[model samples]
Target chain A: MDFDAIISNLPLYLKGLWVTLQLVIMALAAGFVLAVPVALAAASRNLLVAIIPKAFIYFFRGTPLLVQMFMIYHGFAQFDALRESFLWLVFREAYWCALIAFSLNTAAYTAEILRGAIEQTSFGEVEAAKACGMSKPTIYRRIVLPSSFRRALPAYGNEVIFMLHGSALAGVITIVDLFGAAKIVNSRHFVPFESFITAGVFYLCVTFFLVWLFKRLEHHWNAYLRPRETIAVPTIAATAAD
Target chain B: MRKLVTAVVTAVTVALVSTSVIAGEWKKIRIGVEGAYPPFSSITADGKLVGFDIDIANALCAELGAECELVPQDWDGIIPALLAKKYDAIIASMSITEERKKKVAFTNKYYNTPAKFVRRKGSGIEISMEGLKGKTVGVQRATTHDNFITGEFGEAVDIKRYATQDEAYLDAVAGRLDLLLADSVAMDDGFLKTDQGKDFEFVGPGYSEVKYFGEGAGIAVRKEDQDLVDMLNKAIDAIRANGTYEKINSNYFEFDVYGG
Candidate 1:
């Protein structure tokens, strides 16, 4: 309600947005890297290859990220063996734990999304690549991946937004992300509306920016797939074929 | 025809539930409580809310001649629930502070306690900033103890804020945190006395400065409920004068926690 209070707290929210941006970008990048192989394997014809990725996808997607975070941040520390391990160094830091959990969770979801898109790739284009003596790897690299990515862009964009919101969970573990900043402001000032609404608008701005960015990417990448605006003309084959 | 009947039934049901609250009477009331913080409020094994805060709420309700139902709520959303009219009053051990006064009204404090930090028995950690440098300390988020440590020692220590005091205690016991901060009485009865918390001991000076702690824990109501506030305040005074407060105090603590 108090615009002045919200304005005064802009610095805190901006700081929070920076932290949120870092988490989202890092997690998305990591997830993208991991998801590529998983999606590839998931799209494989070999049951063994497909099953391995499927299991990883199933586990991460099945469990809640919050539970995974708690298990990493607090649960593993409960064990002496884990404490003695080198992994403890990363596990001890809430930042790393949260990032890993978010990355793994998003990777599973992104893999599934990419897998669906890959399955939808045109069989005609694939057959054309095969007829031209393109190897499996080249076919996937030049034909399938590009087409699948273009198709998957919108859904993946949605996943990015969900992950952006999901990064708010980092606050519960004390990462000082956007929602964390909102909580601090709310706690300090007892102004929930001013505190949360400020963060809400920032999230909205980020979402809009993301949506616009994805729209541009889709427009350019899928340009060839679009129906061209053209003048009606008779083809030369109609007159010459007979 | 069935869909039309269903629509009519749903509308009537919604309206009846919406307007059912008995206005201007304390005959029946819903009290929000977090049954997680032990010794103050917690859920027993049999699913009953049994603790000092519950006893205090019961005493207050008896004084008001009202039937009170203690609704368990997450501490994070307790205030919002009160604001949303999910419950009339909060009997959670919510500290009374100027910040809180901006949103909801609080009755006179039932009890007050200093905040303290507990560390491992053999850890040799001092409470000073230099000694606590690079050490991880855990406290429940949004708590007075959390604000105190963050305000005072944020530069010196790595503070990990938990959603609940119980979570902080668990981490402290598990050695994930070097130390944990919380209400002294809660630390004493809720954790330090428990088997899981046996490895840790209070290591810091108790913090009771009014600037950080404000007044004691108070029953909270919406700001517009002045009549309810007055009635609750009178009930609190009556409980104290009639020794009901003393009885509940003795049930929870060995010392006077009224903060007077």
Candidate 2:
């Protein structure tokens, strides 16, 4: 109904989209890096090695992301020691707090995904690597981790999309992410439907783009799982015999 | 004789009840309130809603002889909820802005207060464009204070709009905010009086710019609720004349909130 309002507020929405993009991309990158070591630790045979990482993953995964963010943003700020300490520079800003919360939360979830994939790593593959006299660390590097990453690709894609939606919460801490921009526009103009619908459209577009991007990534990563293309090679050999 | 007296009393009581029911039309009314702004309307520790606005809402309902229900709503959604018929009236400390008048009718202001900025004591922050430039200022989202700061100092200040006054106060206490702009009374009673606000003090002079702050806080209802508006206006007058308003006022503030 308010096309004009939507049209005029595009710049604000674009600005918000940029913030959202920055937050989600940075969080996902950080989470993925953290998850690799966490997944390895959690998938360990020794309980002592695994318990701490397991607890960390469960703690982040079980609680609400919003509460985690509030605890970091609002809860951490209540401490005088933390405020006076050198870490206060990072803890003082809402952007860093949100980024920390998002990264930790996604890391927990991704660690579980990678852990499951690691645990399900084909025994035959590891045995074959050992038969070749590959060392434990070398085996993990050359065989186990890469295969698990390939296995984890589809689920990791889903996690990435989930993280994108979760990034909307950044606005709560006063970051002008996409949803925050919509709230500002709605409050300024009092046109809730127009403002929010525009935000929803932006989210939908990003989500669709993520889905397409992941589909491509999955196709490339899991190419080994697909049936081999023998038809073209067989046809060429038959022509040579003729 | 006792039986006859009981019968007579019952008859008179029933007659009074019937007459009052007939005279005071709207039987059931729902009022929306923001349970976040302290000393105005906020939830207590045990989850009971208490404050001056709650007291006034109760008194008005008593005066109207209507069963009232108070619906705690967030500030941003309060007006939209009223328009959507989520509640019959909003007694939240909503300023009677001309912008709001386009969508809803307002009763005469039940209370009025000017907006002010608060910062850390001895911070020596000047209330000017050059002084506040690039400084982060927090305000409750969608409020008259938000409108004023965004309009008057949007370019000069980095405005952080919070969902509630409490959040803004929290940020101010956390030192995340360089300044906070809110109703002078709310900041005084809600934050500055609290232990967390010990280091903070009001900075700029109180602002009551007619274009932004409007004519104080009023009871907001749907545009079609003219009859309800008239009834509420009359009840407001009755409470003021009968000293009920003063009793509610003194409970929250030391001085008059019914600004001239």
Candidate 3:
């Protein structure tokens, strides 16, 4: 209720906002990149190719992110050999540990989403491509991937927002994200509601921006679907003639 | 539709099972404490809960003629979990602040210690706000140390908040933090004894702001548990009078650190 406290703590709130943004962006980018091959492996027919990534997705998704973060940051550090290993350089820092956990967790969910979308792509499209004598690699690159991405777009948008929210866990491992900063303010001012509300608003703002971005992306991707003249039939007819 | 029904039925079954287990009668009192706060409460290597609060909780339950169990909860969630009925009472070294008084009741203070800061020895750091400029400091999340660092040090030092004092201590030892701020007794008993904190030394005079740090650590009970609070307070007073408090205090700390 006090505008004074809110105004006074704006800088700290901004710092938290920045930290949250970094965590979300880095985690999402790394996770999406890792998710592509995992989804491919999961969808493949070969049991050997599919089993490992399938298990990885299942294990990360099954356990809570808090436990995963702890196992990586604190639990693994208990081993003296781990400290001496090359992994210590990354494990020693809380930020890297949180990043690794968030990336893995988001990758699991993203892979599942992408796998579902790839599976849903129309069988007719593949049949048409094969009828045209299109190569398997070409069929996948041109038809399967694009259509699957379009199908998965909306769901993937939701996942992006979830990843942003999940990044709050970084505060637990000592990364000074927005929640961490709000906690600092609460402890200092003894005004939990004010500080938390401010942090909540910051999160809401970021979420709104993400929603807007996804909407734009969805619109851009759907641009080819806009009703148009049948002139496009000429190009199709030429390809058919060939 | 059959799959939907199965999912719903399974969910309902699981919910009922869990609720029944949680809603069971108060045959045994489960006490919550931050296990990293040593001499007061801590988790042993074998995962058993021990320390002053553990012993006192058992003793108090003996007086109440009830079986007592200890539950380890992170410091930040301690109060909310108690309110959520996850535990019967909190014997953790929780200070009684006026803000907290609105939600929960506290017994008389059984132990008290002023908050202080610890830094690496020969780090050339003095115990003043200016000395901490540009240094990174650590404190337990949702604690008075977190509050004090922000209020006093502000942007002069980097404030790293952790879920446990032990985590903060680990970071401090790793040089991720230049200083760690916490209760004097906790620093003395827990951190000082740890191999990582051997080179760490306490700097500066202890400070307290009643508005944030509260009126020292007391047993937190539900506000409705006025009867329970009275019984616990009586036992606390009796123990203090009979020198049991001193006996427990001296066991963990070399010097008496109670009654700040």
Best model number under TM-score: 2
TM-score for each model: 0.86, 0.90, 0.69
Docking class of 2: acceptable
* Whole-structure CA lDDT of model 3: 0.82
Residues A178-237 of candidate 3: C-alpha lDDT, one tens digit per residue: 988777666545466787888888889989998999899988896676686566455777
**Share of real contacts kept by model 3?**
0.28
Question: How well does candidate 3 score on lDDT at residue A113?
Answer: 92
Q: Alpha-carbon error at B148 in model 2, in Å? A: 0.9
lDDT value, residue A78 of candidate 1: 82
Model 2 lDDT, full chain set: 0.92
Candidate 1 chain B weakest ten by summed lDDT: B17-26
Docking level of model 3: incorrect
> Which pairs of residues clash in candidate 1, taking residues 3 or more apart in a chain or in different chains?
none
Task: Give the 10-residue window scoring lowest on summed lDDT in candidate 3 chain A.
Answer: A183-192
lDDT of 1 by residue, B134-189 (tens): 99999887878887898899899988877788878876766679998899999899
lDDT of 1: 0.88
Backbone clashes in model 2, listed as residue pairs: none
Which portions of model 3 show Cα errors greater than 4 Å? A1-14, A37-59, A79-90, A116-141, A181-216, A223-242, B1-35, B43-49, B54-74, B77-91, B95-109, B119-133, B170-175, B194-238
Best by DockQ: 2
Q: List the residue pairs that clash in candidate 3.
A: A187-B147
